[model samples]
Target: MKAIQAYRFALDLTPARERDVLAHAGAARVAHNWALARVKAVMQQRAAERTYGVPDEQLTPAVSWSLPGLRKAWNAAKAETTWNGGRLLVAGRRYPSSKTCSGCGAVKTKLALSERQSECEACGLVVDRDLNAARNLAALAAEFDTAGSGPVGGRGADRKTPLAGQAAAKRQHGTAFAGQTGTVPPQGGTTNRVPVQAY
Candidate 1:
């Protein structure tokens, strides 16, 4: 009822491309951990200063976990310099397509590394791998489509963060994402092109 539509971006990844994807993921993870550490450290420092009732400016700078900061960090990561994996466009925001599911709108749920295909038992959806996640992110992006939220993936704020931590089940990304697009991806995604897992 909320102007729901599918958002999908296709990435052309070869074995080399796959490596780049992994690299981008690694860079993102590093930035996240680094931001967290920085936040914790600054918080500690601020608490210590609080003993003397120091003012806000006197405290160490708090690490921002917003989306812009994350993009800046990722872009600056030397490891990911050559591996700029294309970002998935959801609603209008960018998100990690691999981690989320296309079937049930879950976030960061574990999909075995070996398990390229996503099968959503809860929704009875069967999906490929990449496309499935892409569609999931798309639906999530549209959750607040009317809110007119700006690009979500750019800043440290994940576009899908709003849907964080409620994955009781896994729905393949392509399970329904392909349907959103009008035509289903080839049965079993072609190696050259990532297939739509959910239908």
Candidate 2:
């Protein structure tokens, strides 16, 4: 199996280079805000039509809020915004990169947007806000590389089932709790297993 890897390096930018970087960052922010505004406008328009009892087919066409759609819209309007060309990279929305400790898998429950630097309690690593997040992203990418394109082991492998008419892989429900000292009652009229508690 092929293993993927990534490396990250911190840049030491000259004053002019730093200014250019800041300019591009500002442009990216402007583009993102513009795209969000456009998406909101379309959504509001659709909602207004619904209030007017417009037929579903006759309603204003819905627009996608996905990155590609936003990128296309931004590209068309960037000229009007008077921003010279700058590539906009969209990071994943879900990762709490800035709030996570790059040195350890520790997550902070709360972090304010105003905090520009963070000190990781777990590893005593103090880093700039953006650099810390960039490091975390690099770490995440490295982890994904190691996982590779293969059937994962443990819970994932256990959860999989053979196609219809194929022989059972082996009853795993009972096996999951086989090491427990106490006896578990049978569930759903099937093999005995520990009851799964719903959160």
Q: Identify the candidate with maximal TM-score.
A: 2
Clashing residue pairs in candidate 2, if any? none
TM-score of 1: 0.25
Lowest summed-lDDT stretch of 10 residues in model 2? 153-162
Separate clash counts for every candidate: 19, 0
Residue 152, model 1, lDDT: 41
What is candidate 1's local distance difference test score? 0.57
Following a full C-alpha superposition, what root-mean-square deviation does model 1 have from the true structure? Answer: 28.4
The whole-model C-alpha lDDT of candidate 2 against the native structure comes to: 0.64
Q: What is the TM-score of each candidate against the true structure?
A: 0.25, 0.31
* Residue-wise C-alpha lDDT for candidate 2, range 65-131, written one tens digit per residue: 5568888887777554334222233458988999998788688888898889878888888889899
| Best-fitting candidate, scored by lDDT | 2
